[model samples]
Target: MHPIIKIESLSKKYKDAELYSLNDFSLNINEGQIFGLLGPNGAGKTTLISMLCGLVKPTSGHFTIQELNYANHASKIKKIIGVVPQEYALYPTLTARENLHYFGSMYGLKGSHLKDKVVETLDLLGLLKFADKRIETFSGGMKRRVNLIAGILHNPKVLFLDEPTVGVDVQSKNAIIDYLKFLNQNGTTIIYTSHHLAEAEDFCTQIAIVDQGKIYAQGTPSSLIASTAEARNLEEVFISLTGKNLRDAI
Candidate 1:
């Protein structure tokens, strides 16, 4: 299968940073696969995803999403990719339905089509009853689910999420994962970064372990688990590669 996203010699250095945020990174994500980016804090995972999403420009190198390079085809690329950042992207004053309607409009969806989609997704995520509630009144899990729906309402070919399940309850996490699985099953490729290893172990088809701005390892979760001597799970593999260092750099 062809990769939906390709990275080549990707590197990034912030203006005042002493070291590159990403160093010579390269990766390929196959279509329909859930690719996990696992790393310690300050390990460059977010920087890598930010570059791919065009939220941050790389200092050097390039990436292609569905054969379209950001340098020349960014507009085209944007049309087919969805992004869910760590922070909530909804307006606190708006109702859930209203918030989604605004987001869908940003993607050119409108009228009955957008309305139906918003209603359907809300119903699917078990939020139909709360559609008229202001976002400020919702729980963390509720906001997270709505945030996910905002990115996916356009039905993009690829989706990128950062710490998507953070600060959410178990039921909400399961709901988010189930919804993501539904999208992946229907042909959306997922690329995400998170410190949640046990969740990634079950959720990701492929995993990349990055540390100090480089990919230290990449493979299927089982392959990665078996490759290490006595490494039992994703967490063990992570610890083996990233060590116990406290990445407290400011």
Candidate 2:
């Protein structure tokens, strides 16, 4: 099958920055694969994801989703991909169902079709009973779940998640992961960035270890572990390639 997402010599530089945030980065994500972009803070993981999700423009180079170029098919691409950002993208004052309805409407979904999808997704994520509850009253985990539902209400062919389980409790993380796994199993290609190496090792079908805007290694979690000498797990492989130094930015 053709690659679901393709990048070629992609780079990004801020107007006043000294170096590119992403430098000549390129990778192909195949259809139905749970691809993980693993890196430390300031590793350009977020920059790359932002460009892919059409949230940021690349300074140079190009990429395509399902052979659709952003320059010409941005709107079409938007309809095919779902993004679950690290920040909670919910209206605090809106009810869960209300939030979902609004998000679905942005994707051009409405009437009974959108209503049914919103209800089904909320029910599947175990939030049906809380549908009418205001988002401000919900716990962090609950908000995260609702955020997730908002993204997938359109049933996107590709999903992009940035640190999908960063601050929540184990229960919430597990619930989110389980739901994502279910989506992947049903043919949604997933690309995510995470600091959680163990979770990525178990969840990702393919992994890329990036640091300083470049990929040092890319393979399945097991293959990556085997390729690195004396490394036993994804975390070890990560440290061995990216090092343990701090990457603080001003």
**Highest lDDT model number:** 1
How high a TM-score does candidate 2 get? 0.98
Error of 1 at 150 (Å): 0.5
Q: Which TM-score value belongs to model 1?
A: 0.98
lDDT (Cα, tens digit) per residue for candidate 1, span 135-187: 99999999999999999999999999899999999999999999999999999
- The C-alpha stretches of model 2 lying farther than 4 A from their native spots are none
What's the true lDDT of residue 186 in model 1?
99
Whole-model Cα lDDT of every candidate shown, in order:
0.94, 0.93
TM-scores of the models, in the given order? Answer: 0.98, 0.98
User: When superposed on Cα atoms, how far off is each prediction in RMSD?
Assistant: 0.8, 0.9
lDDT of 1 at 200: 96
Q: Which window of 10 residues has the lowest lDDT sum in candidate 1?
A: 241-250
